[model samples]
Target: MSTNPGRVKKDEGFLGKLGGTLARKKRSKEVSDLHEEGKNAINAPLLPSSAELLPEDLLLEENAERSMLDPTSREDPKFKDLQKVLIDWINNELEEDRIIVKDLEEDLYDGQVLQKLFEKLSGRKLNVAEVTQSEIGQKQKLQTVLEAVNELLRPQGWTIEWGVDSIHSKNLVAIVYLLVALAMHYMAPIRLPEHVSVHVVVVKKKEGILQTAQVTKELTTTTEMMMGRFERDAFDTLLDHAPDKLNVVKTSLITFVNKHLNKLNLEVTELESQFADGVYLVLLMGLLEDYFVPLYNFYLTPESFEQKVHNVAFAFELMQDGGLKKPKARPEDVVNLNLKSTLRVLYNLFTNYKSAD
Candidate 1:
């Protein structure tokens, strides 16, 4: 059977064209699919690699579950007591500024109160906005404040456990840890309830499965544990080993006293002799309490020894009224210029009102 050569050639060409068209369509579909995948890659969220996951990142991921078991949420009695003590201490420090911190999470999340506190404790101002309303602004302010704080604490070899995101997110565990650290650093007079602990939910990923475990975390350790023995016995150690440092302590205390008393046109030069008369003591109490003591309540001149004792006693009474812890020193001891007694009273006042404006 002889087929026509031209017809055969034409049929082969047509088949070749059809095969080329089909191949072109297949290539176009593959290219389209690859382009679509590229677009997805560009639009998709970039997640951290396994090696990039930090402890803080892990903690943040578990926040939702951990929050439910937080101390503030559960109202754990011990934790509540610790919170009250810390809150009261913060309120006392910020009393002059009229900033009250009822909840550590809410008030401190914005970083304004924390900034004020750092300024009050360190006597150094931070370069940050006075008020930040927006969430981003608040976080920026928190970063600045925490950086400054870490700089201050770095010399002491303190470990910072909180981060900006942790604090801004109102992580109570991180918040309380930070507050406790600040209190210890500043030697806040208020006693933080010791050995406070809370239950927390810790999450981890194993293989591909999520695992959680409840853990008892200690919120605060005692001062002795947090600080070295020398820090705990600093005054006594200074007195015994380095008596000259006592002068520095005295000078610092005098400076602190004069700073507050300067408003009344008074300066404390001699801590022992000047306060022995009891007039300065009375005025100091009145100034710190933000109230005026009636002239009749205390003697202005106080020449007589008994009159001086009476004035000192009246100042002690005012201290008690102002919610200050009662002084162990007797009124007569202060009147007699007993350095120990005089220092005890003044130190108490200084601890309580150092943040006073």
Candidate 2:
């Protein structure tokens, strides 16, 4: 059909504009969708795969677990002070070996420092290697050192609470427990800070549910508390609360003294009064050692208080010379007829020579 050219051109233009409008709208919708998708992606959490977890991520997890389980957190001021004290003590002991422990976990994880410390404190050499580079070697050495430590602690009535794995894993709680036990057993001169405690959240899972509990634990050992009890004077307590027990202990001591003193024709009838003069103490020591204490060294009669003090002090010196630990009793305390002091000295001697013929 014959048509006007201008009209056909207008019609074509109108169709072209309509097509362009539709295409623009579709493109704008696609762009908006893509932008929304990008916003969602940015807002969503990115969870890495198990294989994608890095060493640092594992370390962070380990630290978090350790913090949760440890009695004292690393951030605690008391823990820091304790760490510094323990480090200083180890350094002082290992000074001759030229080993310095700056970080307890890092330095001790390898077991080299622990080996040296054990040797120094125990005065016995371990069969482990001086240094180990491999993980297996380090673990083996740790096992050996810890075995020796356990053996040493056996006689002290202490049960080991740490393992080679725990120690090798850089478990601070286990490490501190071991060190404190060693310090207490070897009688380390430093005083461990006491009553350090913390509340820890214990997490458990059961029946597809997570459970948590708060527990309080003391970081320091009860050895110091036990020592405080001993320092309160058990004999004094016995005398006040249980005189019959006191009489029994005194009778046992008297029998022990007379058994050793029978060679010198000395018998202790009154446990408290006889030892006050210090004559029996010196003679008892001489008899126990199978040596005659020269009469010139101690007063036989002890006419004055000064002479009594001298005699008792000389007897304590003899006790030390005989390989007995120094008693906590003072010479003046013994001379003043302090039953506690007298009993303490006699008890020490009795404990040592009870089996002697």
Quick one: RMSD of model 1? 18.7
What overall lDDT goes with each candidate model? 0.77, 0.77
Minimum summed lDDT over a 10-residue window in model 1 is located at: 45-54
- Per residue, candidate 1 scores C-alpha lDDT tens digits across 176-291 of 88888887776565446668888765545444333455567787776334422222344456656998777887887898889878998989889979988789999988888889
Q: Which stretch of 10 consecutive residues in model 2 shows the poorest summed lDDT?
A: 45-54
Q: Against the true structure, candidate 1 has what lDDT?
A: 0.77
Q: Write the per-residue lDDT of candidate 2 for residues 262-328, one digit (tens) a residue.
A: 8888788987678887899999999899998899999999897778888899999999999999888
Highest TM-score, which number?
Answer: 2
